[model samples]
Target: MPPFSRVTVIGLGLIGSSIARGVRAHMTGVGLTGYDADPQVRETAKAIGLCDDVADSAGAAVTDADLVILCVPVGAIGDAAREFAEDLPADAVVSDVGSCKESVVTALREALPGVAIVPAHPVAGTERSGPEAGFAQLFHNRWCILTPPADADPLAVERVAEFWKRLGADIEMMEPAHHDRVLAVTSHLPHLIAYTIVGTASDLEEVTSSEVIKYSAGGFRDFTRIAASDPTMWRDVFLSNREAVLDMLQRFSEDLSALQRAIRWGKGEELFDLFTRTRAVRRSVIEQGQDDAREDFGRAHD
Candidate 1:
């Protein structure tokens, strides 16, 4: 596939800057323009040569871009799309790296009618945020889910897919609604639980808190690591994907209540069954090569 030619990246945070690196390394002839609300991030990106040009605004970045990627927080996606909607080149394929697909679709679809809007979410991240945290290999071997609307141009979708393929991401296409629901279970609810459990630990009295930190290895530490992710991004994710998150949270709560009941009633067999089932999940994830095996992060407490 031909290089995207001129690609615009709006919001040069972790995902955006990483994509910039991926595009620069893999697509030789492409010209990349980046825009971020944070001036420091823009300057840092420019200093590091992350983009050929750093535009002052989203409109300027998308002026002639063949592919315009909105890589902002989920809530900011609509406004960013609207900012450059009229100026995006006619053949431009506008897409996003927003974690939640359903809300992002509604936002961009209303703003850019004629342009091809391909919604995508790269299923990879670290606890860090901003340009400094981005690396070219962030998308390598990762799942990049694309949610193209039914009326979206096939060639546009293919081109977008091909663009991500160059970034070393495996691609899968699904409806935005399905994408949101699946992510709610796999990503959103887990993040919410992490935040909640970490917050609970933080509220403990100082003496207990110190002990909690010193002895966090039983599993609470894992939650803290996820809870350390950028607050703005996670807040927007929950607010924008409310429906799916709530549905999944309901299911999760019921399961938790069952486990609570098992412990309260001293039901050894029930606890064993639940633990066995959950262990199988870990096994399956590991067999699929999705597990983080090192246990190397157990001590990084909040």
Candidate 2:
């Protein structure tokens, strides 16, 4: 049996629309409903047939849903849930796809008291937004971390896990706080560094913006891709998970100081060891099937 008969997705962006497509592809019997705060997004979703029904409001969207997944930014989760709280079915399972878990869980719990809340992070996406950017294959090998509260119903958690599994995701259970810290280092910190590096390049007085773009190396080009991610989503992510992000940032700063000293003192051996170890980390990531092993990260050139 399918995990859910009816699934409603709020916020019709990349992740939201992808979930709609995944359900259509993998669960033909499932009823998919979608809604977004923007009228243009709703119209676009309807035009694309992204869902069985595209409701005009959040409340109307979840009125009959057995599962409602909020795909809004982390900072906007509570407001989105609150908008539909009165209309949400008593037995519906509420979840979200925000990167930060602890804050999301707290927000959901507060906004919809007594609802079966199962906070999830898909750990998958691209540097793109809007309904058009979503695809059913986005979660094919991705991790979907579930961070349910201690008192959450076990069945709800299992159903949510099965739902993601049917959508081609691997499921992992984690404590909300631990999930936040782990993601802080693995995902959030990397985006932060990418943004900083790209911004620094743009602000350099010695280099014109045109020169930077025209002579972009592979590393800088990759960083630019990461930096180009949706600013609203990333802004909410950083603020919602500030404690963990700040802690990880401090550690990164300390390590960066060490690297600075190593370079200034002509410590070739130290630099070599660091580079070698980091290269092994990349190989391990590829070996584990988390990334491509092809040259230039599987990029194609004409």
Candidate 3:
């Protein structure tokens, strides 16, 4: 049985459109509705036939939905939820694709006091934005972490999990704060580092912008891909999860300083051991099917 017969996505960006496409591909009987704050985005979604109906307002979009997924930035989740709170069906299950769970849980609870909120983070995506960037396969084999509140309805949580599973995701349950801390180490910190590295390179006085681009190596290129992610979304993520992100950042800085000291003192054994352990970690990630094991990360050079 399908988890939801009527689904509404309240943002028309990559994630939102991908959900629509995934549903159309996997759950053909389910109805899909979509809306975006930007009129241009809504029009684009309509042009692409991204949803059965493209609503002009958030309230109208979710009126008949059994599942409402907010694909908006983390900073806007509360306002977006509040926008349709009055119009939301009494039995609807509200979920979101926000990276930071603790803040998102607090915001959703505040905005929709009686709603069955199931905050989710589909740990998947690429350095792309807008409806055109979405595809049905984005979530295939990806982890979709669900952080439902302690008081949340059990059936609602299970339905949300099944919904993602139908869309080809593996589901895991987690506490909101723990989800935030874990993601801070795995996703948020890496993005922060990428942004800093790319920005520092751009701002270097000795390196011309054109030269930096022209001489980019594989490592720098990968960092640029991560850094190219949606700025508004990332900005909201960092601010919303500041406490966890800062804790991880502090630990990373200490480790970085230690590495600098080792390099300065020519501690070859220390550096070698660190590199060996990190390499083993990368192999484990590949072994667990988290990434490609092919040479150069499966890149095709034509």
Tell me the TM-score of each prediction against the true structure: 0.95, 0.99, 0.99
- Please provide, for model 2 over 44-138, each residue's C-alpha lDDT reduced to its tens digit, 9 standing for 90 to 100: 99999999999989999999999999999999999999999999999999999999998898899899999999999998999999999999999
Better of 1 and 2 by lDDT: 2
Predictions ranked by lDDT, top down? 2, 3, 1
Colliding pairs, model 2: none
What global local distance difference test value does model 1 have? 0.89
**In candidate 3, which residue ranges exceed 4 Å CA deviation?**
none
Global lDDT of each model? 0.89, 0.95, 0.95
What is the clash count of model 3?
0
The ten-residue window of minimal lDDT in model 3 covers 210-219
